[model samples]
Target: MTGDAAAVAAERVAGVAGELAARVTAYDALRDHRAVFAYTYFRLTSDLAAGLRTNNPPFRAPEWVADLSVSLAAAYFAAMDAIDTWLGPVPDARPGGEVLSADLPETVPEPWRDVYAASTVRHSYVLEEVLFSMMAHMSYDLPLALRALAARGDVHHRIADFHRMNSLLASSVDVVQAEIATRYCRRLRSLDRLFVRDDELFTSYGIRVARGLAWFNCDRLLDPDASAEALGSISRSTAAFIAEFRSPDDWRRRRAFQVLRALVPSRRQWPAPAAPVAVGSSPG
Candidate 1:
């Protein structure tokens, strides 16, 4: 995309972001993060559909990027709902009438805010946005959330809850992809088949990697001196990576073999249907 076209796309993306933020404030359903995620995805779905009809996507990238966003937004929405449904509500870190125990409004942890804010400015690739989002959410937001809420005594339960949410996201991969294919990628549906394998790696394996990063940061957040430094370091690293990480190849080979060889499943099979595991269950 040329400078002019990119600017136009960025403007559209910013509008989408702004519209979503405004909806969160206005709509009661979007008052919480999880529900807000659902609203964001719902609106994004509508915008993406409009873009598809007009042939003017905000990112000007492939439909896969939009599909990826759809899947991610769905996962986030589902995870939040699943765990929060079972555990009840978590306090908004943002300032309101409720007094927060922390000094700040539990804003998006360092690099997360940076990465997400710069989604339009940083890179052209849709996957890059995904990468930056993963780092921020897993490394910064999740840990801060743990620290800001989850009582010390219930830390284990919260961690389990996090895993449960992550698992819910992982399980919903197919459903999200199908929705994207139906709604966002109708024209590109046939070509999208070639990328089907890639989406699985991107979503399911991606969540596993994200969970690992979250665990890494969660441990740091549990410690006083390390939490801030660790988050800052992650922010710095993500900043550097986003600025420097690029190539003409569009990360194809990278995606083909995204996961490590050791982590590959042994003739894998999906788990059977089970109840939404309760997040507030007392750790045995």
Candidate 2:
């Protein structure tokens, strides 16, 4: 894509990010745990859009990164649409600004289904919800998004840009974590020190590991000789990882999560969902 085209794509991504931010604000107002991931994603996309607009963009191939970002975001929104279809609409949450689509997917991806399903259970930990959402998006959707870009004949040379996103993501972690704490769980900020591994799990080490695995999966998907069985195996492994994290069977991790759960406010303690707000309005 030309420079002009890249600028347009970046603007489009900004608009989508704006819409997502609006939704996240609404969800946060409702004390919905789903907001954990939505808010994080909104920040990442918003940052990417801003980076692309800068004179000295961090990425080597801004256009390709913009396209990949959009494709990956589409997967998340598709999952949200599916969740909305399954559980009815979130109270007072409506799409505003640049919306992706009015149509919902016929079937949600299994990994996403698992994430959303875990989200609905009242007992689920805030940290787990965040991690589960990230796992689903990064581990499952990212490779597919990369594969789509490869199919378009643009991704082969953009691997460096893809890797560059890790730094951008790392920069956003502190900001995202702070926002989540202020909006959802006030205890989250300090809890990380209490549970150091949990902190690294979502904010740093785990993300790099997941992204590395995603690129590997993308390479596999791009292989001309790759088989359906191989793809299925990848999907199963991703799903299994999500499941294991969702409810850690190991005594130590489970016990740690249990302690973490007690440290944060329970779902019932949250204020009830507020009345619908006007589109484009900021959360109070």
Candidate 3:
């Protein structure tokens, strides 16, 4: 039984997501950043899909996976919208000669490209996936985005906005983990301790550290020497790091990463969450 077939099935891919992009791209003053914003729309959509809600946070999978994924989607969504506000549609509104500026296709840019490439690594722990994804976005993609636009009108504001959106993203982490992780711990009692450690590091400090790197990269973008070479190096190196980085083999401390990773849920057994139900309408 159906009325309009299209309406019956939600299109979550880029639904309503492009409003920010549309607003940003419409500013004639922001012509250069058009593609960057467009690609960002695609990513927000993708992450929305990744973290789509499910009844069971954990059968076998780690709970934080979906929460982190959803938080990132929301962060990027807010970040893009904030950029629109920051740049100001009125050409004469801000510094830097009238204005400042701001996908998913195989043709998309880096950091994100690295994220997509790493998407195939299903074996990564949920926290690992979260960190790696953040690294690619903050450290690689963002600075590269500013680099492409070549606008430094309000550098301080740019940094502030970056952190503001970050705070927005971080605010959700506590709530998500508190709710989902409790249930996940019940399901796999043995792994609860490992998951707890992951949460502590991630929430207490790991995320902020990564954000610091991202802000630093934004600073680098302002450099004339930071061109394609800089972006390329960051992208390549970050991808490799995401693939391989782990806690160090310790001294006699006996708390080794291998021990924690061994306790990580087997994707084979628990399986990553399924593709989420489409929730909203797609952007044309």
Worst 10 residues of 1 by lDDT: 275-284
**How well does candidate 2 match the true structure in TM-score terms?**
0.78
Candidate 1 on 98-162: residue-level lDDT in tens? 22113222233345435434433311223343445455555555555555443434455344434
By TM-score rank, best first, the candidates go 2, 3, 1
Report every candidate's CA lDDT.
0.42, 0.66, 0.42
Candidate that would win on TM-score: 2
TM-score for every candidate vs. truth?
0.43, 0.78, 0.45
- Span of ten consecutive residues with least summed lDDT in model 2: 95-104
Candidate 2 lDDT, tens digit per residue, 1-284? 35676577678778768778777766667666677778777777776676666623556667677788788888888877776675566565543222222222447787776666566554565666677778778878988888888887856677777667776666677776776676566766554345445445476556777888888888887776774654775656645765566457878888876765666545322433663322222232
Model 3 C-alpha lDDT per residue in residues 62-142, reported as the tens digit of each score: 122222233344545554445445445675663342211112233344455454344333234434444555565656655
The TM-score between candidate 3 and the true structure equals 0.45
Candidate 3 global CA lDDT score: 0.42
In angstroms, the error of model 1 at 12 is 31
For candidate 1, give the lDDT: 0.42
TM-score of 1: 0.43
